[model samples]
Target: MAPQTWLITGSSSGLGTAIAETVLRAGHKVIATARNPIKAAQENPQIEELGGQWLKLDVTSPDTTKTVKDAICQAGGSIDVVVNNAAYSLIGSIEDMTESEIETQFSTNVFGPVRVLKGVLPFMRAQKSGTVVNISSIAGLDGLPSCAMYAGSKFAVEGMSESLSKELKSFGIRVILVEPGLFRTKFFSTFVEPAAGLNQDYIGTPLGDTLQHFKDLDGKQNGDPIKAAQRILEVVTCTGLGVGTEDMLRLPLGPDCFDRFQTKCDALQENLTMMKKIAYSTSY
Candidate 1:
């Protein structure tokens, strides 16, 4: 594949910034968007210095579609890859989270990317060639304690990406859902806490324990953002670097993600086997 232009969301820091830098290093053009373009550039001058354009974009805002479309036009009128990495972590139990909080979480994690997809689909369809990489999480594959809302949002991404991959295949567009484990990113620093009011009776259960564990592991995650970014780059380029197959639609990054994915698969298989008879009977 020739050098392609990439449009990445939330490129001010963490995996997004790493990805933007990696793409530039690979001699590709990049449009890195953040909520505050000026602050983003001040924080990561290498992005602009590497010939990548930085634009102010709020994925949750209704105006993002036009902003992205205009940016695409400015970037030579085509984007070969679109990486949706703009999302924040919302840590809370389903019962403790308010409707407003849950809606906000979904707005950023699910609807934001959906809007971007709708905004860019016309161009990608016109060109009949492009790749979409949705940044999901291991929690997307398995519902974990204390991360119900976050996981639910990612689950939406996973399902949408699966459907999109099929829908765009005939048009020569591909979709990759990158499920990553805990990485040393600003994600931890910016995690949204549960609502102000807490359930007193549920303070010391597994949910509480899980929340504590996450707090303790804040700055000590084992995954490296730069390496994860490089892997993502390979996947986007179809280069198979650190990937088992170039045609894979789902890429799980980090050892923790690999382990958790295997566990989830095994559990699913076991459940299916145990229910095979009942499932077959239902079909009849």
Candidate 2:
């Protein structure tokens, strides 16, 4: 297979760095982006050593579209794969979350990818081939207490990816959603924090428990970020486990994520079966 160029966001740590390393090792060119290039270099010191290019990209910034386009132009004017992986989880009860917090969550997690897509899709369309990988989470498949806002943002990504998959199918572009379960990464070590001010009314509820659960699971997560990155690379490159899955849409990593996906599908099936008559009546 010919070496392809990959552009990944949030490449400072966690899955982003893992993917960057994996792609570089496979002899592909990688353009890794982070909000702070200096800090990203500090976190993933091997990025430059591995021949991956680092660029400053803040998904929340209005200038992201231009930045991505410029980076692509600099990298020989062609991009084969794009991984939208920059996102932070905002854990808090819906009542405890302020409007500004909600907006920030969506702006970063939801609209961030939108900006990258705007910057790259036109080039992909002109070339008539490209893969778009959106890094989502298990929270996207099923909403959890204390993670409503984060889940809402992910759910929006899920919906948008589904729609984009259809819209771009004719153009030979594939859209994939990487829904991962808890993985050992800085995401838990540094990103997971409760709302600024906890609501006293909900202190003893599941919201509090969920927050504590994430803290306890920080360094103990069973999933491996490197392995996850490998699987993602294989899928994107159409090798190994991804050989026959060219049309597959969602790539759910980890047993935990698989089980959750099954549960959600089963519940949806049951609801459809039970509400078929009522739903049909409403149509008339």
Candidate 3:
């Protein structure tokens, strides 16, 4: 296969760095973007050493979007892939979070990817080929307590990607969403913190324990970021888009994700069937 180009966001650490590394190791050119080029440079030295390019991108900035587009164009024209992976986690009860807090989270988690996609779409359409990989979470597919806000952000991405895949299908662009369970990444804890001034009055209950459990799982997560990166690279490089994607757009990568997704589907079906019994009684 011919060497491809990549535009990876949040390349300073965790999955973003791993994904960027995998592409570089595969002999591909990468345009890695991070909020802080200095920190990104320090953490991901291989990007410089391995011949990949790095740029400062706050993601939320309009100028950064234009710069990314310009970079992709200047560097050999078009990119083969664009990975939307720059996002933070917000862990708090819905009641504990302020309206502004949720808006801030959505701005980054949802609007950030939308901006990146808009920047890349023109080139992809002109070339008539490109792949977009969105890093959604398992919580997106199944509602989980204490993670409602984060899950809402991811679910919106998943929903948008589904429509976008079809919207760009005729233009020859493919959209793939990877829904991962808890991974031992920095965002699980230190990189993220409980919402400022959480409602401690509701502490010592199941909800509190549930929140703590998620935080505690940070270091103990079973999924490996490196392996996850490999999986994403493999899928995007597939010769053709997979089957039934229009109906079911995202892929659940982690075992926990898949099982939980399945359980949720089953429960939904059961409830629907039970509703049918009540609603169809006139037919008897």
Candidate 4:
């Protein structure tokens, strides 16, 4: 695989920063983006030391997306990868969350990547060689009760990525969805709350497991983000076609993710058998 240039959004901290650092350490140039350029720069000295470029971009903003794309195009003439990683969590049941909460989550997690993909698709097509990496969560494949907004947003991303892979294959653009499970990130700490009029007590029962996951993972998340980032880049840069889906599709990182994937697979197989046993009336 040839050395590539990576453009990663939300590079101020956590997974995005980890991705940028990994790319830089791999001797590839990176375009690190954040809503506040100065803050992002200040927060990531490692990236700065590595000479990675920084840009101001709020993924939820249409105008910013366009400008970031234009800037990227004007810079290295082409971008090898675009990692859409700017997103936040909204922890609440569907009814518990206000309209604004849902809108805000969708804006950042769903429409943000949609807007970035639109802006980059033309350039990637013209270049005929690029990768679009959408950072989704395990919640995307399996629903979590308290994370209705997050799950909905990630489900949108997963579906979009699945269709996009087929759609862009002819254009030489590969769409990979990164499914991370219980990574140690500030994402849980920053989750948006229900409206002021709403009661926080709703967070106790139905949302119990969801809240516990966050608390349990506070300092105990088994997912190492740095290694996760490097593994993702390695798979994306892998050579030849025979190695199969690892080259250009869903990449689930970490032990927790692996376990979840296996569990889902087993459950799916069991359910399929059960459905087969009851297919008589349904088949007609």
lDDT sort, best first: 2, 1, 3, 4
Instruction: Report, for every candidate in turn, its global Cα lDDT versus the true structure.
Output: 0.90, 0.91, 0.83, 0.82
What global local distance difference test value does model 4 have? 0.82
Q: After superposition on all CA atoms, how large is the RMSD of candidate 4?
A: 2.6
- Residue 143 lDDT in model 1? 76
Model 4 clashing residue pairs (backbone):
none
Between prediction 2 and prediction 3, which has the larger lDDT? 2
Any runs in candidate 2 off by more than 4 Å, and if so which? 192-195
TM-score of each: 0.96, 0.97, 0.91, 0.91
Which regions of candidate 3 deviate over 4 angstroms?
191-196, 239-248, 277-284
> What TM-score does candidate 3 reach?
0.91
- Give the Å error, residue 219, model 4: 2.4
- Worst 10-residue lDDT window for candidate 2 reads 188-197
Cα lDDT over the full model 3: 0.83
TM-score order, best first, reads 2, 1, 3, 4
lDDT, residue 182, candidate 1: 90
lDDT for each residue of candidate 2 in 207-249, tens digit (9 for 90 to 100):
8787777778878988999999999998988899889888999
* Model 1 poorest ten-residue lDDT run: 238-247
Among these predictions, the greatest TM-score belongs to 2
